[model samples]
Target: MRREFLFLSILVPGPDHPKISLDVFLQPLIYELQMLWEHGTEAYDVSCQQNFNMRAVLMWTISDFPAYGMLSGWTTHGRLSCPYCQDNTDAFQLRNGRKSCWFDCHRRFLPSDHPYRRSRTLFTKSKKVFDAPPPEIDGYTLLEQLRDFGANRTPDCGGNGHEHVYGAGEVHNRHKKSIFWDLPY
Candidate 1:
């Protein structure tokens, strides 16, 4: 059976509503799903034999990058906006206290395991800035170095315990809120 979650009224204005932002619509939907998952039933087939345990309810949401960032509770802009490599991203602080990353398309040419991948401190602190050697390994050969981290990547480590995937601290009005920084959930 197909199912859908009604997030808001269709009568509401379209994108031009100004007040109707993507996150505004999704936050309630996500909260409802979280509530349902905590107190909901699993799908069962009449013809199939029932087991002792109830089936687990799982939800998967698909959206574009901006929407995904809103749903996942991560920064979408600024130097630290990159959810994957922000921990190791090389950025410099401006007089205004905002960080600006030096984005060079040439860095993509570097190997996945290169010291520069983890942090930019290596290159920035070096004496010779312009002088650099060609990467010995190609991108295709360096895929092994890439490993997925974060709660989204490994949902069930099955060790310590479990936690809520979606949560927040003090919110900024109804439209903006601080997303929990731990995991996507």
Candidate 2:
């Protein structure tokens, strides 16, 4: 892990957010990563005293919330802000601010016997939470769901020549199928 942190690649310039166009910048990196996964590079091993094939897999990414949306193709704003919850999100539009807010949405995840679950005044007034947490969707299932969605393909941005479709079917908050889905694994 420490050796992996020796180098960091910052793809974009600062002061402006890339939004959906981030996939364009990530194309080269994704191609290189695909090559590494398929056919590893040769590296000299100092301790082994021989050259060996070196391969790497991208386990995860580190980024702030806004950037997370860009990378994952999920919109962080609006009522469907949460990728995990998907269409089941309890977020509501604020009456005054006219913005989406997720207040008191986590009570469903608390234990049934927990006092917070029954405290009406503590959260939304007189509201009792009996709902269970959203089902956990695995990576393969997600990939299967997005396979035909034309991921990383935006017609305006030199994509795969497919028309960009937003909020298609159950993928409510998604702007585009994420570029990371291009990885075969």
Candidate 3:
């Protein structure tokens, strides 16, 4: 919904050379990059004098997939929208049956022993319990690790290793190569 504008200022003012719109000059380049991103192996050419190999291709932009799609002339919505998980998403149908809602959360990435890694229910609302506390790898708990790695402040920890840092309902759409980070390795 946000609109962005690019201004190509002219140093020398003249009516003979008319002003050129930014998109008119940039669209072809964007299209070429999109082609390279989607079909790099086929679109890449050796004579182009630019590297478009697998490593170089992977080192492109780091924006969310939807933003990438917007730049590439691709629409993103519905069930198969998530570029990382794709169809493996945890989205569910709505009451109207026409659309679905996505509820990807922190629980999916939490360790099994982490107290926040549980489905909430009415019975457990009054007094939540945990079988084990979160592991302290290399004498530092997750809270300490997060603090050491500059998270501003340590999350509030309730006895059984429950830390309320990220909300349970918060969406974590960023790509993660590894979820199990028992650090100091």
Backbone clashes under 3 angstroms, per model: 2, 0, 0
Alpha carbon lDDT at 140, candidate 1: 39
TM-score of 3: 0.32
TM-score of candidate 2 to 2 decimals: 0.81
Top candidate on lDDT is: 2
Model 3 lDDT per residue over 1-185, tens place: 12442332323345532111222234444455566655555335558766555421222334465545432222256654554444345566667966866553224445666555555663234434343332333524434434433322111221123223331123322121111121112
Off by over 4 Å in 2: 1-7, 147-171
Q: Which scores better on TM-score, 2 or 3?
A: 2
**Deviation in angstroms for 39 in model 2?**
1.0
For candidate 2, write residues 1-185 as lDDT tens digits: 36887665766888876667788788888899999999999988888899999997787888888999888877788888888888888888889989888999888888889999988899998998989999888988777666655455442446434355545534566667777887877
The residue ranges of model 1 lying beyond 4 angstroms of the native Cα positions read 1-12, 17-23, 49-60, 91-185
C-alpha RMSD by candidate, in order: 13.2, 3.3, 20.7
Alpha-carbon local distance difference test for all models: 0.39, 0.77, 0.37
